[model samples]
Target chain A: MGIALILVSTLAAGVPLRLDLVLPDHARRGKAVPITLRLSNPGPEPATVYLQGRPTAFDIVITRADGTPVWRRLDRAVISSILQVRVLPPGQAIEFTERWSQQDDRGQAVPVGEYRVTGVLPTDPPSELRTQTVRLRILP
Target chain B: MRTPTPVQALAAGTLILAAACSDGNEPTAPSNETPSAAMQGANQGAPDDPIALARGVPGFGGFYLDAAGKPVVYLKSAAHRARAEQALTPFLRSQGLAPSQLRVLPGRYDWTQLEDWFSRASAGVLAIPGAVFVDANEASNRVTIGVQQGSFARIRGIVERLGIPPEAIEFQETMPVRLLATLRGRVRPVVGGLQINFPGFLCTLGFNAVRNGQRSFITNSHCTNHQGGVESTPYYQPSQNIAPARVATEVSDPVYSQSKTGCPPGYRCRFSDASRAAYTSATTSTLGRIAKTAGPNNGSITISGNFNVTAEGSASVGQVVGKVGRTTGWTAGKVTNTCVNVAVSGTNLGQLCQTLVSARSGAGDSGAPVFKGSSNVTLVGILWGGIVNPNGSSTTFVYSPMANIERELGALTTF
Candidate 1:
């Protein structure tokens, strides 16, 4: 099993405003899964953006191979009302990352198995901004 | 038809950059297009409702007034001018109206037939592969269809299949319309100075306010439908059809009161162009913080920080103040006029005791919050309309003073 966790960052081209997710090919079990989120401006022009409150706006969900929900980032956590706005220059990016332990919302860790992970940057006035689900393996 | 109202007051909706007006007549224009003198005329069209005139005249197709304020009616043929005038005499304001005053023009089709073709074309226009949009152009008295140039022949065949008369439709070359790119425009805990979308218009929020335990935000009265007596008009943040976008419902938009004291005999008058929309959720919006952008609008705009409100006060002529709006971003200017009587042209309504600022603003900026600070400032007023030249852009922006806003909306806590 591997020991390090890494996720590559990328910026989409052509599209004016985009939020992309980055994850390393695959990671070993028992190690913390480092996930990265970036709100990028791929278009040539600068953009004025209003973001949903931070930390709260970023979410992740882990599921079984067959698509059953396992753990969600925002389940019972109370979210405070927060509104944020910032200007993004062309070709630039902003990042929000979270390290997820191999465990679910509950403190218990799962047995060695294959799972799928998805990231979401639910900006306000929500858009079709979700990361493609990636397969993962938690080695015993 | 230019009203003799002050130059600064007629273009008052310049409260916005895209210049959205909060007066009952605003956002009547598309919320995103730049507020231009021509656009205002197009939105308000002729004050006389020609469609209403088309109601009875046999084969009548259109109606309009000449520059001299005389009525010019359109009929299926010049032969019907005498009969048409006889038919219209009962309903029209015929006094002082010379027989030559009721001029009649030739039209190709009957208004009824055009209406039927419009309905059929509307349901079938988009079915044509290259068709972009459809409209019942009353002035031309025909169903106007916008389609790609190369696809005209294909659309013509498709139009025949849809059973719409070929002679009744005018095909024009045009490209498809697209939605604005707005990934960063949506806000949670909805803040002031951002765009707000309604059925067919976009406007800016003024400021978060609280009156007697109720939480809400202020925009222009025109931002709503102006059908008073209910909190019915719903607004969405950034745009419609998105989750968690419903931000507020109009709660207060009082009808304009008329008086010889401050208003013309036919025009309506009000203390402020302000109105309130209660937040849909208790925690859906934030109070006193307005979005700030680094510079003027240059196509791609971005928010920098916010001008946090600290107190509430008034400004005198020559005193500088600033406002942030969806179209123009953040811009400021000196107080040009402390108070003046402003007339909203299209609506035949006037605002009394309003303030004017010589600031750079545009369409969709209506309902922007006007204040007197850079980062920390005192709440002063809410932007509504503007004053512009007959064929020029607006140079002065107008607003409802905080004192007048409170007087019209009742006491509210804005900071």
Candidate 2:
């Protein structure tokens, strides 16, 4: 009976959250590339997700084909000091689009090559939810 | 192993050679070749060069260096790309370079298309509630329209019916726009963040300005006049006594002048929510720096007499900007939109194009100076109002660019 009750409690806790990274297959060297981070809750019960950063709630990292880190979205200084939390509803998906100027952390143009772009969502309790690696090719 | 013969060693060395040898008598590559055929054709009889060729091309949008540090030309469309390539290929060959040296990329829209959209939108063809702004995004090669959530579908349909391609139009969600002003009373000195006291209202001064040789300070037009009218009310700075001390008289508040006609061709009507107050003292009286805090606040940092007025410049989307005001002392924000048309509620002011910054600005923060950089501040605009969300959180702060303000008021920021 205890095991069955635990199963029921777990079912009532709602489904696990999922995050997807959306990026273009190819982009120009100096052009701005739009990257979308989509968060979806597929369970019946709604879950509250908190965004804990100023200006933007998530972070992005772009690395070369050999896994050498190139650029990071969080490296840019935040102008607004206010931090915000956004709530996510059940069965609904929310996406935020951020643009990358194809430059590295030092504000120089990134070399033309295949790169791996990763999106990470920082949650409470010092946990991080990472998305699947998305491949991007920088064309000259 | 057996020793290799001299001939065999020579053959191996020939295969492993790192550099090739050429006879000194061989003809050398031309260092100064005549201009390409495409360049000559594009420039006609004038100076034939890449820049001149780019300018003379019919559908050329612009040129920028690519990742390989080669010049690339942006053409209006695929058809234009084809024509441009055909004209330049022969010239590239004459210069001992391949057609690929001069890259041609397809542009979503040319300069003409963007200007046409701007002119039509400013002329009220696409004017509607919820659609608060229209601006050209050069980086994305599209025209972005900011609209309220309720009016998104309607605005999208209207834009589509007007022949704007679906891919070339972007819509952003925004709150209903309103003017930043309230009924209050106070005044003080400390140019940018000081209070301006009118008859029954108070506002923050934007910046100390100079028109011709006269010294003055600028503030929101709505501060001097609630309704669409002008008033020559005496201005005062906040004082320890009950009544503030008179510092200047309102010389011009032109926000509500109906006698003026439409702006001349190629220029949109200057819908400025700014006014200039002639200083009662000498030009050296007011400091040129913005206050670190409001005058009413005890920790206000006054501008030094030696401070210089930085040059005024335009704000780009994604650029960081800072502001000092009465309510929200010193705060920094990012420019979200450069050209935004806002409709102020409860006022006869129909719509005005403003520069939108993401910051926390309240009712009393209107007319504050929005500047860029910390040590060397460059004046960008004047705080007019902001969109306060239902929960009282501000989505964005709206201000008029200094370029428009200077043209409208015939004044510039004084050092």
Candidate 3:
């Protein structure tokens, strides 16, 4: 450990970090879609937050309008056992971007359809944090 | 652990993927680390200086600098004045002083006696949770025990049972101190004070080293899946998914000792909170170098790898020290107490003979390297835990001393 500055925010100060998913509204079939997750500390005070892993630490799901699952990231992938925690200063943000290759978990190209992408951050207590869902449309 | 459940169409688990780890926080510049004038002439006597220069003249008393920075050597009797002046000559002249400027006074107790009481009372007092520190207060001629607010009675009872006379001991209430481990970002050919990840947790890598022709790095044993077990748990830089490859594996993590030799009541003891991970190739590691952050408060940019560690030694009380971690880049403070037996709350662990520093530390700073020089460094210890502020940062922290590190991990050539 070299140097660290913990803003030392209280739990009453709310969650120390904020999380969100960033993706395009639509992508053409067979083309890779970039999935970005941003974790930031918007501080009036310092906060301690955790992310299980980078992109792998989150469960990114793409489902149809009818709630039928289209594809899932980490659906059967081995989640690395390591956990990461950061007591971040306010205004500090870390972003992770991964490519979703338009294919389903089974390696099949998805048919053009309306879809929604959501992310979940699972912590040790088993209380999972879910991001607001974003809509996506796959083109033929 | 963000793993997945395949049965559910929308998995509710975690996965490990590599992401470019970056720190968005600004860091504070660390103060230069040098012996404070008040702490000069410590036990490390130059061949020319008397061994008791600052620690006091044993039966006479101790030495200190007055408000104007002049040397003050206190004694128990006017008869010792000549000896005190003679002992302070070379050190005084070196500071551009004549023996005429030396101040002498009759002190209440011999420093040697107070130091003995401190040593005798530390482990037992620290065994009580909330007993933050045990210090030898030179000016007060008493052994000071800093107890957290609610822990006073518990600490007082233990100290009383240890047979220290009430007049010779002092108590002060303190705030909560938390264990700290911190760091972030992926740096190739990793260095100390960077983020290293293990299953279910993350911590800072202390230093890169070599043992028996293999490269290795040290981190807090608590960062491992098991604190003192050779589980061979793999480690990753910054985060595991970045390359999905481990930087090293736990090779040695000494079991907590069952014997109570250094332990207080009801605790298993370990000399250091350290664990070593073996690197398979020399190409993936470097030795004696810590990840250098931009000078103080600017630790967000860690590309420079020039902070050099030239030697390993014990940190004396009152010396300044610094550390780097993934979370808080660079923070520095003074070494307040030495050889304190620290108990980690919520665990059965008692770290014996640890050093305490008042610095800015936070979660994820575990295993951070602590050095004593500002321009360069003399490696002293590794960050393990601290008393955290309400905001989650540490104002006073604890680390395993170099001697203790070697006690359990064997002799190491850590420059």
Q: Please count the clashing residue pairs in each candidate, in the order shown.
A: 29, 6, 56
Q: For residues B167-188, what per-residue lDDT tens digits would candidate 1 score against the true structure?
A: 6666666665533433237766
Off by over 4 Å in 1: A1-140, B1-184, B227-231, B242-244, B295-300
**Candidate 2 structure quality by residue, lDDT tens digits, A52-116:** 32223466778898888788765422212111234457779777678999998788998888988
Chain A TM-score, structure 3: 0.80
Per candidate, native contacts kept equal 0.00, 0.00, 0.10
Q: Rank the candidates by TM-score, best first.
A: 3, 1, 2
Among these predictions, the greatest lDDT belongs to 3
Specify the poorest-scoring 10-residue window by lDDT in model 2 chain B. B1-10
lDDT accuracy of residue B127 in candidate 2: 62
What TM-score number comes out for model 2? 0.37
* Candidate 3 runs further than 4 Å off: A1-140, B1-183, B297-301, B389-393
The count of residue-pair clashes in candidate 1 stands at 29
Tell me how candidate 3 scores on lDDT: 0.66
Ranking by DockQ: 3, 2, 1
DockQ values of all predictions: 0.01, 0.01, 0.05
User: Model 3, range B134-241, lDDT digits (tens) per residue?
Assistant: 776544445666666666667767877877766566666565453332246667677788888787577788988777766899888887878788999888887776
lDDT of 1 by residue, A13-106 (tens): 3336666666664566767888777777766787755543222245677888897767766543222112334568988978877777877657
- Measured on C-alpha atoms, candidate 2 has an lDDT of 0.58
Among all candidates shown, the one with the greatest DockQ: 3
- Regions of model 2 farther than 4 Å from truth: A1-140, B1-189, B226-229, B239-243, B255-270, B282-284, B293-308
User: Cα deviation in Å at residue A60, candidate 3?
Assistant: 34
